[model samples]
Target: MKSYRIIKSPTEGFYKEKGSKFLGFAYHVNSLEDVKNKIELLKKEYYDARHHCYAHLINDGNQKLIRANDDGEPNHSAGDPILGQIRSFDLTNTLVVVVRYFGGTKLGVSGLIHAYKTAAEDALSKAEIEVIQIKQSFVVEYGYEKTNDVLRIINDFGVEINNQEFLAACTLFGRIEPEKYEALKDKLNLVHVKVSKT
Candidate 1:
C-alpha cells in the first residue's frame, strides 16, 4: 500500500511567451475514462487553440501509469515539462493539459518549455492537494452466527462497505486500505470467515 497526493478540484492557469499563449488545466482523475472525458471537454471548449499537449500521472494499486504527449510542438518541449511539474509536486492520479494559442509569433524550444512548465506549475499551485490511502476491494462471507464479529472488525478497521447481502450467509462487499487488508483478513480467517478479492 502507498499514499500519494492528488488534486481535489479543477484549476486553470495561463502563461505567454513571445505572443504565444498557453492555458493550462489541472484535474483530479481516477481512471483513463476520466482522462478521456476531460480531454474531450477541453478540446471542445478551446477549439481555436493550436495545440493540446497533455500529461498524466496515475498510480493504480498494481502499477503506476505516466504519459505525456507533445502534440505538434518540438519533441519533449511541451509535455515533458508539464509532467516534470507533476513529479515535482510528488502528485499522482492527476492530469495536466496545456492548450496553446499561437499569437502570430513563435517561441523556440527553450521558451516553449519554460512557458509550458510555468503554466502547469501555476495551475497546480492553485489546486487543493490531498493525500489518500490506496485501497483494495474484497468480498467477505460468513454465517449469521458471526455477524457481530464481522461488524466489529469492519468498524474497527474503518472499512468502507460498498454493499451487503443478508441471505443464507451474510456477505459484505467492501474496500479497505491495503496496509490493513492482510491483518484484517487473518483475523476474519480465525473466525472461519471467508474473504475473497473483488
Candidate 2:
C-alpha cells in the first residue's frame, strides 16, 4: 500500500473574488483532529468571510474514510467539489479548506464547482508533495577517520542521519529504508562499520 505525507504548515492563501468566483487553498494534513483544528484556526483568521468550507480523507492500511462540509454555501456546490479534488489527486490523510468572501455577485452551481476545483489545483501547484514510507532506525559506529566516508555511504543508501555524537570515535544515529536492511548491512560491512538496529 502507498503512504502519504502532510504539508508542513503556513502555506495558504485566497484569490481575489471575481463576482463570487471561488478563491481558496488546499492543504495537506496529518490527522482528522489536525484537520478540524486547522479549519477552526482559519475560521478565526478569516472571520468575515462569507463561507469556510472543507473536506478531508483519512486512510489507514486497510480502511479509508472521508468527511466534508459546505460551511454555508449551497448543499453540494462547495464541499463536494473540494472533496472531488482530493479524490482526483489520489490523496489520503489530507485536508483542504476553501474560504470565500462573497463578491456581491452569485456564482451558480457550475461556477461554484469550477471555482473550488481551480482553488485546489492552484494550492497543489505550489505544494511540495512527497511519498511517505515506513523506516527503521539504526546506530552506526566507525573510526573518526571514516566519518566522511560513512556519511557518503549513508547518503548513497538514501538514509537520514538523525543524530550524531562526536567522541574519540564518531557514532551516528540514523534511519534507513526498512526494505533495504540487508543491503545496507552488507554495505556497512565493507567499511568495517558496526550497524546496530535500533
Task: Note each model's CA RMSD in angstroms.
Answer: 2.3, 5.1
TM-score of each: 0.86, 0.63
Model 2 deviation from native, Cα RMSD in Å: 5.1
Q: How well is each residue in 2-101 modelled by candidate 2, as lDDT tens digits?
A: 3566554434545554666445666666667778788888889888888888888887555676887888777888789888877776767778888887
Model 2, position 1: C-alpha lDDT score: 48
| Top lDDT prediction, candidate number | 1
Candidate 1 lDDT, 153-175, residue by residue in tens: 88899999999998888999999
lDDT of 2 at 119: 79
Q: Per-model C-alpha lDDT, please?
A: 0.92, 0.77
